[model samples]
Target: MNLSTQQKLEQALQRLAPIHLQVIDDSHLHAGHAGNTGGGHFSVFIVSDAFAGLSLIKRHRLVYDAAAELLPSAIHALSIQAKTPDELK
Candidate 1:
């Protein structure tokens, strides 16, 4: 994976004002799958105020909006587990 992804992730977190953010590249797990040739798929654990009062769907949408440009290109799959810090505990 390139630093650009991390930078992009950070930017997204900044936009969301996340209390906690974890980004794990799962591309190796999908090495043979389509869109896996590029460095993209990831599992994200995010705790952010942007998700605090939102429904699960909304939370996902927010994250999706943050990385909208990466979809189907720089990022193919994102296994997102969005939560608030309190919700996580």
Candidate 2:
């Protein structure tokens, strides 16, 4: 069975043990865009110890890897904000 996009993303990123995580589906805001072909647009904000000392690009890659299965299929565009808990201060 296929999980919803948000559920899939949450399950995937659980590996990060995020202290804070928010996933917002923004598909309605992009209606009619070429990439909107049924896939959703999402924005993610995450804070996790696993992100400590990682560069922004590395953090993003980690997030992307977690949700790799959703890309170009259930997800069209993703806006991400990944940070270590300490960085949230």
Candidate 3:
């Protein structure tokens, strides 16, 4: 069986070896939007040491790269919150 978008996100982002990761699927909330189609809407909260010294833009870029195959395809939207363990305190 094919994996869901949420599952794919989790698997892809695992490359960063997050200390904590949460993925929320919000596709149902965009039922009628043109971009909705079969693609999914999601938000991710991830804490990882990999993000330790990166700037906000770079951090987002890292995440984007991680999910590169899903963008504008299986995933219509993604809201990400990337942080380090210390930042979570």
Task: Compute each candidate's TM-score over C-alphas.
Answer: 0.83, 0.90, 0.91
lDDT of 1 by residue, 48-79 (tens): 86777789999999988998877767787888
On lDDT, the stronger of 2 and 3 is 3
**Candidate 2 residue lDDT tens string, 50-80:** 9888899999999998888888788888899
Over 4 Å off, model 3: 35-37
Would you list the rank order by lDDT, best first? 3, 2, 1
Q: Give residue 8's error in model 2 in angstroms.
A: 1.5
Cα misplacement distance, residue 50 of candidate 3 (Å) = 0.6
Question: Which candidate number would show the highest lDDT if scored against the true structure?
Answer: 3
Clash number for candidate 1: 0
lDDT of candidate 3 over 4-88, digit per residue (tens): 8799889999999999999999888887787465778998999999999999999999999999999878888889899999997
Model 2 is weakest, by summed lDDT over 10 consecutive residues, at: 31-40
* Candidate 2 ranges with C-alpha deviation above 4 Å: none
Error of 2 at 48 (Å): 0.5
